[model samples]
Target: MPKDKPLNAAARFQKTLDFSAADYYDQCRNRTYACCFSVENSPYIWENYANGSEKGKACIVFEFGKLRAMLNSALNPEGAILFYNGNSCRQIFEVNYGLVHYVPWGSHRTNEKHLSNPILYTYLKSDRFCEEHELRISLSAIGIGHFALKDGSLIEFPPTLQLGFDFRNAIASAAIREILLAPGADSSFLKTELSKLRIEPAPTSEKK
Candidate 1:
């Protein structure tokens, strides 16, 4: 038997960024798509995630197609597009891209069985390679894993696009929230990008 260790943020971050393309895809071979879940209340999700608690909140089941669509859409300043009940959701997060791949499903060991369901992982840190580019962009990659719940439930996510050209880095939640709360600002570029991706807020839900 193996001992389960507590989740450490620093350690988790380190493990995720140390993978090559071959290493990532080899683990993802012949895996089936599982279910997707939504964290409607992000604070709760973050709190639980921060404490290393597997299941601290309830997640509403979401659509797999919608998740794929949003993730495949053009990168936005708001970060990755998350769908809540099939509508475009801005509250979505990039989930520490590297952590997405390295997380062990049932046990702490890294293996193919544990790599079944992978999602698009976004590297949020800003990089300014050229002074000509105005905005800093994060690199997007693919990963697989899920958040294990205490009650034997798992919240799954879909794979994000790994386009080398897409530079939309994950934006901070505070900034996203501000944009949602205050509708007016200089977001012409953002609006144009969202339109290109066919992303819109769910009719029933308020912009968050």
Candidate 2:
């Protein structure tokens, strides 16, 4: 008989950021929308997450149109957190209170982790801001296969935009984040002139 495939074991436990929900609640600080379980009673959630029971449950990154839906499901209006690393969410895409896909400010991640859900990040300073921004943004890009190494992963092949541009040398993913960050960014493509690169889209509309 053929050997059985290895089971996809649950993910390992991890510690959450060093801040209590009360600290954020008192001043409405560092609470972004659409990330984890709850900054409130976070210590309790942290304990559970550290025990490996919360692995597959947490959000990983954006999933197209789900961001807005999750926010509306939040139990508390102030439960929103700045960021989330899909690694930390207790439920995959467990958004609440109209907060689906809408990432809050000052949230953090040193590398790309928003592939599975998009609402994972660490709050900066645990100090939340009142006013947010116009339109949401994505920190990473959707790739052909599994995520690439942090160093120079996205590349152009015969780079060309169907919109009539070339970006043979542009860091496509990071550049998108930049364009979102700064207003009036040169929203142009085709970094390597007209005839130097190639870019193509998927031939089918099937979901992976």
Give the per-residue lDDT digits (tens) of candidate 1, residues 1-208: 0112221111232356654433444334222222222224344443443243232222223333443344445445456454433454443233221221223334543232332233332211122311122111223223455434445554444454223322222221121222221123335655565567664433556544
Off by over 4 Å in 2: 1-10, 13-116, 120-127, 142-208
List model 2 lDDT by residue over 1-208, tens digit each.
0010111112211353343322222212122232232313233443354343322222112332343333343322355332222222222122223222333334432233211221322222222321221133212222222222235353322222111112322323222111111222222432222224463322457313
TM-score per model over all chains: 0.18, 0.16
Ten-residue region with minimum lDDT total, candidate 2: 1-10
Root-mean-square deviation per candidate: 18.5, 21.7
User: What residue pairs clash in candidate 1, if any at all?
Assistant: 118-143, 118-144, 120-159, 120-160
Candidate 1 wrongly placed segments (more than 4 Å): 1-61, 76-108, 111-208
